[model samples]
Target: MAEKIFMKGCEAVAETAVRAGCRFFAGYPITPQNDVPEYFARRMPEVNGVFIQGESEVASSNMAYGAAAAGVRSMTSSSSCGISLKSEAISWMAGANLPVVIANFQRGGPGIGTIQPAQQDYLQATHASGNGGFRMLVLSPMNLQEAVDMTWQAFELADKYSKPVMLLMDGFTGTMMEPVELPEPLSEEEVAAIRASKTWAARGKHGGPQHKVMCGPGLDTRISQEQMNERDAELYESWKTTEVEYEDYMTGDAEIVLTAYGITGRIAKSAVKLLRAEGIRAGLIRPKKVYPFPDAAYEKLPLEKLRGIVSAEMSIPAQFAEDVERVVHGRTRIVTALSSGGEVLDRAAILDAARSLMK
Candidate 1:
């Protein structure tokens, strides 16, 4: 068995990315997520990897893009505002079908709202990560372990689909410390295999002149662009069939179901346990893959027995609830348990919402 290691969220995630064969990282300093790049700054050299604290988020994003464009495993990390700054480059990478992993330790928002944790970026991360009509595989982790595991998965998924993948974590999850068993590092042969498989990646004249490029409007370019879009559409559709992941807790016979993501989901889980002990038959649905939305989990619920659905989050407008509502489709009453302005969703608040749904 791999020995367990106790580490903070940012360090664990950064180290895990290294073990996953990521050889390049470029990021700007941002609250909560700063530790991620800080760790890489020191450790990346030991692994013969490159780490650059770009002049700004914009520069860091393009640095990552250049590295990945050259067939290297590359990544970047930042908070909400920093991510906003990187959006244009993110879209460019998507259009080029370049695989890169990004980590967003989200903070309260609109425009540099707060440094405290919040899920207000839910819509931005899922609905529109960039200007193009592109989709990213967005994974949200509720705990330190999940964050570490998903960071590793993010790289693999990005390579598999040849597109950018995001790990969406809030400030709390990105700063908390916990015990976790880190995976073994990938061998050089494995890393080489990953790079070798990408025949289309830029490799100078050694691979002969490459003609594949990102979006364009010329006659031949137009035809190829349409083909690429169609292929990307199919890739996105496959995630629904193969990658939608979520956790159902005490939901078998529950009278009310609480839906959330990230730390809010973790809190709702605690509320479910408390309500279960009181015979309220409360349950929780925590989506692991936020972009895919795990709507199928709701379909499997005992809707005939369900009384209500509670959407919990650290956002005032309840960014995560929009999709939950679309899935519930008025089969039951829907209420929100929200904590804004950098506050976390407490179990007591979730408990109160669950009880109110019972009423």
Candidate 2:
């Protein structure tokens, strides 16, 4: 049995990953997400695993790539700028179909943005996490508990799709302390089973056919291109069926829906409560997974009573709002309230936007 505790978001995610039988970790610490590695560094020794702090984000990502290629569950974490350095590595990992969980404790950006939570990276994670036409399942968690839960799921999705999975949770949502339930670490029996069942692992001493997991080999460029195309098509196809985490709060009879994710969704939820207190029929659509955005989430809303959709995000321009538009399909107007890092959108601003849409 796992113990329940109140913990920070990043810490919980780290513990969750370790408990799930992740044995390799390579990362550089940044604000908000720094605690993740700190916890792992202390906790991993108990399980006799490896925790390496690479010289740079580039080195850390490469280490993660190597670990995953060796067929062990591994991970890497970084903030916005750090994520930038890791783009190439992520692309390569996806091509090789190496499954490693990535945690991007997002914050403000464009350059080296502040250490404040922001959902602006939605484009970074959703549209093209890496370059090219490739795609990975980007799982977005809205709170501390969700952060932990989704980290485990990310590993599962990555291995299943033979691709990388990023757990997208922002700084505030990643750093804030919250209550959560945790499961006991994977047992030794489970670890032994994983090692023995080398269906796709590079177990160092193979006595069978050569197993080469590479997205691109210098010899056969065409094969690489074909694989990329196939994976891209599958990713898009999966997008329709991939929206696994989405919730509608007080939206049953709502005319206008507020769309947000991560901590911004929490803020929007508070705004919803206040709006309801004032007899405003407002609702919120909180998306847990941003990449494979939910399909037909607002199906029941009356088109006539529907005034408009409002997006509150910690980005300068609305990042999460665009996904809402993709989901809306011309059913309503789209309004966005923007903020970056420390500049959070006020509840009064959201309430006013909801009122304006009604009028």
Candidate 3:
């Protein structure tokens, strides 16, 4: 068995990224995620990789963009507001078909609401990460182990799809500590092979004149831009079939279901156990990938026996609920157990919501 190490979530993510063959990391300091870049700064040098603490989030995101365009496995991370600053660069990378990994340790937001953890960024992550209507595969981890695993694999997913892949973590997950068995580091030869596979990279020519051009929206002419968009649309569609992931816990005989992602999802699971003990017959459905949401999970629900689904999240006005509503399609009632402005969701609220639905 691989040895387990107790590590903070953010640091675990950083170490996992390094082991996964990421060679470049650029990011600025932000609460709940400062540990990620700090760990990278120390660890990247040991692996002969590069790490830069840019003057600003925008600069850092662009630095990651440049590295990714040059065929380096690159990454960047930030908190909620910092992610907002980096969105333009994310959009540019998407337009140019550059593969990069990004981590968002979410805090409260619309503006700089608070430094405390919140799931308010769900809509921003899955629907509108940037100016252009582009989508990225958004992975929401419920614990440190999943965070480490997702961070390790995010690079490959980004490269496979030729788009940015986001690790959408709330601040709670970023700062929390747990024992996790990290994945094995990629061998040096394996890393080199992966880098060599990117023939379209902006690296200098091997034996002939270079022909690859990395250009974003305005750089491409109208027809080419349209074609690029069409191609990207197809790639996004493919994820629904190949990448959708979710957890259906005790849902077989459930009369009430709780739906959430990230930290809130973890909490909801606890509420499920309590409800089950109380003979309430409640269950939980947690989406692991929020972008290519596990719509099939919702579709397969025993709607005939279900009383309602409680959309529990640490966001006011219910951001995650929107996706649940779209999938449920009025087949059954849907309610929300929400907290915002950095407030965390509690089991009591979820229990009350479920019990009310039962009533």
Candidate 4:
């Protein structure tokens, strides 16, 4: 019987993954994200699943790689430092088209960043961690429920594309305790549906031709190039379906739109409520799907009358603001309000930006 439960978001991720029939969990413990692995370790054995606390984040990621190659639903979890170590393995898994789930419970910075939550890893999670060319399907979770729901769905998405999906949650959401209505466990038929498309997975033959899921290692360069193009096209198409999750409050006729997502969006929503109460005619644009960003969302916006778009981000240089600028298409001016070094944005700062825009 599926029911509401009080649990930390990280704990919910483990519960949800298990509910989705995940059979393998491999990860190195790193603060903020450690609860996820610990939960799996505690519960996985009950379901006859395997949860291994690897030697290191590097090993954890590779273990997931090996499990995915063996045709099992596997996952790994880490924060910034651990995520950095998963880079090479992530690249190899992508090249091999292995289906796996990895989560970056993002904490601040470049080297040994703090355990405090930060959105600074935006470039890392979306931009292939370290490698320059590859793209990863990065899903940003705003609340505990999204963390749990997206963790389960990540496996399905990964399996569908035969790629790795990162469920990016901040330290706040991961550690925050919340009550969520967890979905029911999938039926055996549903499990078979996931396995059916996994013909490319390394499952034993069922009286069918031999199967293979490999990288570009063919002697024929032309054929290898074609396959590479196909993978890129598929990744792009996947991005097209990405989303931004947010709730709009009283944005019907406002000229200046405040765009924020994730935890920042939650705070922005609060700002919206306060501003509305103060007789400020401000509207909010919250993007729930940050990647494959909700481009269609813009069609509903009034661009011409816009004074300027204020991008409220948890990091400096306005990581998301740049993307917002691209989608705005010069239809309006763009300004950014940032909280550097993984700092939280001041609510008054955002409200002031809105007040200034109206001037």
The model with the greatest lDDT is 3
Query: 1 or 4: which has the higher lDDT?
Result: 1
TM-score of 2: 0.93
Number of the top-ranking candidate, with TM-score as the measure = 3
Q: For candidate 2, lDDT tens digit of each residue in 1-359?
A: 45679998888898889888888898887887898788888988988888999999999988988887776778999888889899888888876777888889887888888877776688888878777656777877777778878888887777667678888888887778888888667796786566555466665546666655445433345466766677668776766675467878998887678888877887888888787777887899887777677756755566546888888888877777777777677878878877776666687778888888867
Off by over 4 Å in 2: 1-3, 217-224
Order the candidates by lDDT, highest first.
Answer: 3, 1, 2, 4
Please provide, for model 4 over 213-317, each residue's C-alpha lDDT reduced to its tens digit, 9 standing for 90 to 100. 555324334357557757676766767754344456667877777888778887887887777787776778877656666666665688877787778878765
Model 4: residues with Cα > 4 Å off, grouped in runs = 130-132, 187-193, 204-208, 216-223, 241-249
lDDT of 3 at 82: 97
Candidate order, TM-score descending: 3, 1, 2, 4
Each model's TM-score, in the order given? 0.96, 0.93, 0.97, 0.90
Residues 199-258, candidate 3: write the lDDT tens digits. 889776667664677877668664477787888889889889999989999998899999
Question: Candidate 1's C-alpha lDDT?
Answer: 0.88
Worst 10 residues of 1 by lDDT: 213-222
Q: Which residue pairs come into collision in candidate 3?
A: none
